[model samples]
Target chain A: MLDEQDKNVIRELQKGLPLVSRPFELIAGRLQMSETELIERVRSFERSGMIRRFGAAVRHHDLGYTANAMVVWDVPDGAVDEVGQSMAAFKEVTHCYQRPRHPGWPYNLFTVVHGRTRDECVQISEKISKKTNIANYRLLFSTAELKKSSMRYFE
Target chain B: MNLDDVDKKLLKLIQADLPLAPEPFREIAESLGIEEAEVIGRVFNMLEAGVIRRLGAIFDSRKIGYTGTLCALKVAVDRIDEVSAIVNSFPGVTHNYLREHTFNMWFTILAESKTKLDEILDTIRQSTGVEEIISLPAEKVFKIRVSFELD
Candidate 1:
């Protein structure tokens, strides 16, 4: 568990690292710690899996990856793990997860696929279906991004 | 802005992780065989172009004692903007989108606890008066990596 000071470090780091020759030095100066201490703390966080990633958050739309689809599949309960891992191996799939199926919603496996065009997204989904042999699926394309912001933890 | 080969390479490098060094950019410059200033300048330009949303640490909410869930609401066509505004007002509500489906508005919310998550969902339901909100919590995460290869 992170203490108050660790939370403070996270708050500062999440705002983003300064673009400079010695970015960590500047951040550590503000955090009232040595540069080495700050780096070590971040490294520890990375090692402990607290920090999922520590780098650029690229906007896919801006990068011409405008076509994004949420492809949900109804994989057999026992085969979900196998099918999910197979689908996740594709470079096009960014996020893949297994969620509980609702009364009316039969799809339990979800994967968010990104492509440059709508047809490209469809092709990727088709490819995944072919590989997984799970034909029961539906692609829900996002019409608009109402909001897309990083979670501000400990705020 | 057109991205040259160097910018593409620099982006790919920065997308992974900045080196844990006194001068991280300098380390990156060494790998790419470019001046540190060039890297900083390219990143600045990319930021201006909105190619890079942010450059920071992405914490695992679960590891940090936070609970998150994806929800889809069956909202009426005319109420999208108003409903979205209400949903987006909350700080915990992130990645809200209007998808092409019956349950049009889909979003992911992260809260400090499961109770907090339920509270937020209840509040959103009450505020929007949209009864058909389905909360889908992940039972297992197969993959959650986002990296765009600039070819």
Candidate 2:
């Protein structure tokens, strides 16, 4: 339940902000508030769960790692927590979550993995499987990127 | 975004590929039976409306030099925002969120090197004052990439 002023502050800050000295101050000035007030309001929004974060995204392919994949696993409801906990323990698993399963999509627990090559990525997945006792899982690789951006709640 | 049919069409098309031609937008317009200006207008409109958050390329981190992993911070509910701010401060970190469960604050980072990664993690932990931060380095990679849908 953020008021309009707070929302205005967020709309500008969400995008991987300009790499400047006073990033928060820039948005604050735009919102007609001082830097302290702006940061406080933002902290409130975050504390209230209205704003998730302020972060940057790297240009992956430009760096040379290569393969990235979505690794999904069908763990039992009770084991999902345990297995997901174990999976999250691995630095390679960029994202791990419990998603609703579709009729054709039996894998409920999901994770994203990136590696230098397909073989290396698969090897990492296998290691996760061994650690979590996740004998059954599927790796869905991205053939192409569609859209990737920070969600704009204000819009 | 306040997208009309034509704008939606532009989104559907470039939502995937923005071709290699010099005047790619014009080519897209020709294919769509519309003018180049019309295509540009729609795309820009989508961008302004925030339907198109960014008009650029997405990357495959592994294809690049990013050597990193995902980690979850078991932050107290009261300190979630503080932890998130610290995590987000680092150039290496991206994608931070609050989800249900003990390790509530989840985040991902693509470090240039292991030493850099450790430095980023240590700095975040010290800044956030959260010793419970767990760095889950991916022991394996299974699959990656999301192919966009033009349809």
Candidate 3:
């Protein structure tokens, strides 16, 4: 149960915090609240899991890890937790998930692998496959990123 | 263009959590034993270079009462651009990508409800006229709520 002020805070935060000596002061000033109150609210948000994380969203591609692939696996339902945990242990595997499987879509587990080259990405996936022993998988390399933006809940 | 040790250190620090304070950058600088201005300058440079997409709060859509699904479409290669634009037009579609697979176009849509999410997906399918579409909702998020370590 968030108040209007909290929503306002979230809306402003969704855009981004200012890069300044006192970002919360800037935001708190705009919201007409004390800096301590605003900071406490933000801390509460983090504790309540409203905010996943509060920091820089680094673009991995710009970090020189251009090679990226969404590797989807058809892991056995019984072994999904075990395999997912195994795959997620890799340093390059950033996002791992258990998505529902449709009729034509047999792949249920997905993990994002980032590397310097396509070969590197494939090699990472191969290593994960060998480690997890989940052979049925597809490396869906991104051909083009048409749109990539954070979800705007308040706006 | 490789990052110097300082830049690497700054990046590793910034990627996770910035101290919630009057001067978060200064706190980061203190940890690294660098000038606050230097920390700010490097972050700005990285942002300008597209290394840091944005410095902000990352929210959990589910916790915020948003329902979403990952959709894949086998669009024609020639119509990829057109279809992508149509998909991207929806504000709910946060991520749209052309992937190397039979289902070439993939995107994630988030809405306030399951009904709204389904409606958005239906609208995209109706407008795009792409019959072959697959919607994969998250059954279980085994490893979300985490960030990648830059070290």
* Candidate numbers sorted by lDDT from highest down: 1, 3, 2
Tell me the DockQ of each model, to 2 decimals: 0.87, 0.02, 0.75
What are the TM values for chain B, all candidates? 0.96, 0.87, 0.92
Report the C-alpha lDDT of model 1 over B57-93, residue by residue, as the tens digit. 8899999999999999999999999999999999999
Please state the error at residue A153 of candidate 2 in Å.
26
The whole-model lDDT of each prediction reads: 0.91, 0.61, 0.87
Whole-model lDDT, model 2: 0.61
Ranking of models by TM-score: 1, 3, 2
The best candidate by lDDT is 1
Give the number of the best model, judged by TM-score: 1
Q: Is candidate 1 or candidate 3 better by lDDT?
A: 1
Candidate 1 reaches a DockQ of 0.87
Error of 2 at B124 (Å): 1.7
TM-scores vs. true structure, each candidate: 0.98, 0.52, 0.95
Model 2 C-alpha RMSD vs. true structure (Å) is 16.2
Top DockQ hit:
1
